[model samples]
Target chain A: MNDVLDVALRLVAVFVCFLVLPLVVGQTEHKVMAHMQGRLGPMYAGGFHGWAQLVADGVKFAQKEDVVPENADRRIFQLAPAVALLPYLLVLLAIPIGPSEGAVGQVVDAGVFFVLAVMGVGVLGSLMAGWASANKFSLLGGLRTAAQLLAYELPMLLAAASVAMAAGTVSLPGILNAFAWWWVPWQIVGALVFFTAGLAELQRPPFDMPVADSEIIFGAYTEYTGLRFALFLLAEYAGIVVLCGLTTVLFLGGWHGPFGGDGLGWVWTLLKTAVLAFVVIWLRVSYPRLREDQLQKLAWTTLVPLALAQIALTGIVKVAIQ
Target chain B: MREPTVVAADAADYFQTYSVVGVLAVVGVLFVAVAFSANRLLRPVVPTPEKLLTYECGVDPVGEGWAHTQVRYYVYAFLYVIFAVDSIFLFPWATVFAAPGYGATTLVEMFVFLGFLAVGLLYAYKKGVLAWT
Candidate 1:
């Protein structure tokens, strides 16, 4: 039937986006970091500024030996990559790329809650990898992950709740429809808190104590090799895409182009997301990793209070406007 | 008759939406499985004892892998539980706060709730539980 075909096509589109966007972001990171550091990155991989660098990397990963440590819990060790990677794909499904109904993969009623809850589930993947690997560093990494989750998750939730409160909706599309220009400056503090907490949740640099390579030897992924290791890397990039996309929708006025037209809304959404993704990578290049104490301190003493204030601000403003 | 049919259609659409999510998850797992199996076929797995042993920066690993880690951040976990439950209340309040006539009342009520949460966080902060070191 036409309905079945339509659903299949949408799933395929989402699947392709899931596969492609992460690689694009990964490639951007390689090139951007290289350029920032005055290195040539991968000029030779695909012959044209390494367009096929990640493709080559994929091929290389496929050809590399898959090694499960002798002491690892074999099943969970192998299962962790899928666990890490799948949640982003689910989160992507609920995200609205434009104002139209067809722009989203699935129209969940509680889309904001769905995305946040699903994203929180992804930390378990690293925790599982860390615990099951049976390496000392891996265990330490797992513990750091749990600690990081504890520190950052509350502010992230509170910040997101502020947006939902400001918009007066829990649905992603509904939020987009309700977005006004003043909401940007009005919710700017919440936006920043949400983005910062989101970066910490994704365990991106500066908040990447869980996987501090110098200290913990890649942390929970110390034992992962070849394609399995590559999948975790992909998950990190996919996470970047999701976080940027969510920030775009919730705070940056999803699909609200500066030119004032809805027809090219998806383009505006993608553009804003790309710009934010660049900032994510730029932050990585600009800052060093935070120490454990500093990480927890910023989340609790800084982001948490700031997010609470943003919520109270939103409440007062909403009441005043009414 | 039409009302019941409309509700049934709405229910069907909801399930269909979630079923797509389920399918996407399965496809994701399958994507990994397929790539892994392909790697298994292509890669030369000549695992030696040295390779199979856990990596510890080119030296032999010391102590048990499951060593006694300090539960220094256990308090964070406890804090996480309290705040996570508090956040659950905030979500519904967020939706309710914007409704007409409920704005001022909901704003005052939620602040009281947040005031309590702030007090708890303040207590933990003062007690030094929020400090990592």
Candidate 2:
């Protein structure tokens, strides 16, 4: 009974956090991007700094008509967003949100691989969404996303593999416990490769050709509307949170704050994640999206080789330490 | 100085970790279902024929929507398969590398393995598989 209650409570907390995250992340992105572009952002919705803009947007999204194209594969169209969004939520399970040892959802043995593998499945959603829409542009967008994701996933895995090599374990907390302050300096190249590959995997700016609105008319999401569209948006923000969390856990030394002891671990985790999230948003504001071919070329040639090299370097250093 | 806690020692104990994953998967699916159902209850469904048509910048879409995609995408998948094999080796290598007595010999062997993979990539590069048109 106690185990059931504990699991239920954890689920509730996870659900609540996932629910509230999109509103906060979306609003922050809007305000930050507005400031970067020197424009007023959301000053009206909730009076103070337009904090309730996302809430208003949520209400609006809910109330809009759910439109399905006549030619679309209706079954696949409805299922695509759910499939895409499902992985993000599952990816959360393998990750530790705070610094405490008990902060993780479960102490899975192959925790790192679990998280990355689940996250990789999200591309199926995009691919299905684009293909089912039955629009040329949507098909193009889906194809681009499929190819782009396939390319980037390799480097991302290699980068994570290097970290796994360094930490001597693939579990999240095990990785955390193995770390001191020096892990960053020792594996800075892995850190950079992971972050860069993560950015592309998340399909954020400079790698967002999957849904380049200018060329592909929102790509796979061209036909998605109302609640379905909201699900996709929610998934993207949830993805940002997951990527940032993974970055924190793997690279930044999860939950280890400079001043306080372990009590404030979640706070440090949150702070680091927020900074990474902000950097994700900042990159969105600053860089123009890469062309699809350019994006693929990057993953295949540059990141793949760099990540492989980092793994080799890590292996050498580990042997040298013995 | 603190000893790391072992998550599990046996198969039964390890399965407990997967139960948590199952719980998470349930919660995720439930969340989406309830939210969409709620929106369905609140939102109006006034679909017009025009709105139901494929969007094409205010113009009616001509011909069938499905079109031919670039062949370059196939090549990308081919490369992915190569790296997928490469990554499979990495996981085991990582586990074995930390074991006692598995020292420079193992490291050098892995590099030689990677050297072969690099040569494959170089071959692809020379063949212009990496080129973008």
Candidate 3:
């Protein structure tokens, strides 16, 4: 009984965090970023810093009519938005948000495993979204998104696995707790591999071959607009937050306080996660996305071989440390 | 150097953990309800046909929105799937190979696994599928 209810509540949280928070953040981020670039941001939407912009945007999207192309597959067309949104939402289930501190443990399952399994399934939805989209652009975009996911997931999994090995458990904070002693000083390579792989998985700059606006024309998101587009944007932001959170947990001693005590341990989780998230956003703002061939080569040739080596090294490290 | 909560927290060990997802879902419902209610009460309504047209690339008229795509892309995807699974086996075997005690067993197992990867690669090679111009 509790299991069912827990699932329901998690789903609801997924909607709120992944869906709602971003709507709020998007406006602030837009303003902050624009100011950084020496330009005006959305000032008229609400009072200070356009705080009410997302809410206003939400109302606009909700009141706006949902459009369907006359020739598009109606059933599939309708299903695509929800399908694209679900895997990302499923990601929230395993995504540890709070601190590597104990509080996050209460909210998640064996979070690392849960994250990999659920997050990996997101690609399936991307594949389905493309196949269902009758539009050629949308189709190509979807397929590319799926392919990109495949290319990145391999290395990301290896990196994540290495962390799991060091931690000796798949528990979110367990990975952090292992970091309690030098916080993965023994597994620096593993952390590096995971960071690179994670960037690709999140489809951020230099790895965003899936949605190269200059080339494939917004890729899988070629068809989305208004609230649906907003939903995808929200998922990406929340996913980034979760990605950084997981990384901080796995490598940065998570919620382990400065000297291995506890007080506002959750603050460390958020701060570290936020710092990593800032790096991602900074990278996005500062760099151009990776080219398709370059992206594929990094994944298949470089990262795959590197990840395999790391896996081997993990075994070697395990044998030696014992 | 002693635990603060360890002695006191033991009393709560047998207590049930709160439903994480349930708590989150309730939060989501409340958020949506508030947002929707606010929108209904606050936002002014202004509806007209001009506000509802399919806004294209700054163009008014165009033919129907359907186009044909090449079948080659789908073919490539199919090949990717077959190769991807075949590629996954190599790493596991590689990992198993490193441990000292399982040498001969690992070798035998890897060969058996390699047989499958070989078959797939061979099929792709012979069919001229791997060659991308």
Candidate 4:
């Protein structure tokens, strides 16, 4: 009975966090990006920097007519968004938001591996959306997503392997407890590679060829409308949150305070994740979109090679120190 | 260091973690379902023939909806399979590398393995398989 209650409570926690965090961060991303681009975004929605802007957008999306393309595959088209969003929430389960102790999500021995594999599944959702649409643009977009995501996944895993090597465990909290300040310096190259490949994997700008608005007219999502479109948007924002969370745990030492003691350690985790989230938004605003060829070249030629070298470097350092 | 209040004491406890994951997955699907269903309830569904037509920049879509895609896509998939196999060996090698007895020998062996893959990558590059144009 106690175990059932425990699992229930954790489920509710995951639900609330999964739904709310993305909405909040996504709204903040709009305001931040607007400011960066020299405009006032969402000023009239709810006043005070448009706190209710995201809610307004939600209601607007809900009220809009749901349009299905006449030629599209109805079943796969409808299923794609849920597939995209659900795996990300599953990732949150293994992520230790607070500490290794009470008030955390599930702890698996293969946490990092699980996160990496599940995140890779998100590409399938895009592929389905693109293929099911039956539009040439969607097909092209889907193909590009598959190529770009699969290529980048290699580098991301390599970088994560370096951290796993350094920490000697694939679990999130285990990696956290493995180091103090030195982990960052030791895995800095791995962190950079991970962050870069993560941005590409998430299809953010500078690596967002899959949905290049100018080229493909929003790509796989071109034919989607109403709540279906909203689901895709939600998935993208949720992905940003998950990537930020993973970066925080893997690179920044999950939930550890700088002063060497735990004081509402989840607060520290949130702060680090917020900073990373801001950086993600900042990169979106600052960089121009890469062409498809450039995106593939960057992933395969540059980042993968860099990640391989970083792993070799990590191995040498570990052997010498021990 | 303070002990973590919740620890997996046995195999039973460890397996319980998967149940939590199962619960979360259900919740996620339910969340999407509710959002979609709510939209269906509150929104007016007055779809016209024009609205349901495929979007093609205000121009009528020409040719079949399904078009031929570039062959480069398949090439990328093939290359990913090679690297995927290579990285599979890498993850376990990383974990085992840091163990006390397994040091320099493992390192050299893994590098030799990587060296062979590197040669494959080099061949691909030389063959222009990685090129976009």
How should the candidates be ordered by lDDT, best one leading?
1, 2, 4, 3
Q: Write the per-residue lDDT of candidate 4 for residues A1-322, one digit (tens) a residue.
A: 9977877888788778888999988988989999999998888788788889988988899999888888999999999988887888899787887765664678877778889988888889999999999798998888888888878998999899888888777878888878667878878888999999999988998899999988899888888887888888988998999999998999988788776457678888899999999999999999999888888888788888888888888888888888
Candidate with more favorable, higher TM-score: 1 or 2: 1
In candidate 3 the C-alpha lDDT for residue A150 amounts to 64
- Across A1-322, the per-residue lDDT of candidate 1 in tens digits comes to 9988887888888889999999999999999999999998988888899989999999999899899998899999999998999899999989888878898898988888989999988989999999999899999998898889888889989989998998788999999998988889999999999999999988998899999989989899999989999999999999999999999999999899779598899999999999999999999999999999899889989999999999889889888887
C-alpha local distance difference test of each model = 0.90, 0.85, 0.60, 0.84
Q: Write the per-residue lDDT of candidate 2 for residues B1-133, one digit (tens) a residue.
A: 4334543345566787788888788878887888888988999988888889999777999888887666578887998898787786687578668678888888888798779878887888888888785
Worst 10 residues of 3 chain A by lDDT: A100-109
Local accuracy of candidate 4 as per-residue lDDT tens digits, B1-133: 5445544355566677776777788788777888887887899988899988889888989886789765577777888888887887676666678798988987787688767767887888898878886
TM-score of model 1 (CA atoms)? 0.97
True-structure RMSD, every candidate: 1.6, 2.9, 7.2, 3.3
Each candidate's DockQ: 0.79, 0.71, 0.13, 0.67
Q: Write the residue-wise lDDT of candidate 2 on A54-100 in tens digits.
A: 88888999999899899999999999999989898887767786666
Worst 10 residues of 4 chain A by lDDT: A97-106
Sorting all predicted structures by TM-score, with the top scorer first, yields 1, 2, 4, 3
Error of 3 at B25 (Å): 8.7
Report the C-alpha lDDT of model 3 over A1-322, residue by residue, as the tens digit: 8766755554655566676545544664676668768987777777876777777876676655455454456676555554444555554555454443324424343556667766666556555555554555556666667667766676777666666655556667555555655546666666777778778876778788777777666666665555555556666776676677677777776766665356667677667777787677677778877766567656655675575566555655655554
**Stretches of candidate 2 exceeding 4 Å from the true structure:** B1-9
Error of 3 at A221 (Å): 2.4
Worst 10 residues of 1 chain A by lDDT: A254-263
Better of 3 and 4 by DockQ: 4
- Model 3: share of native contacts present? 0.07
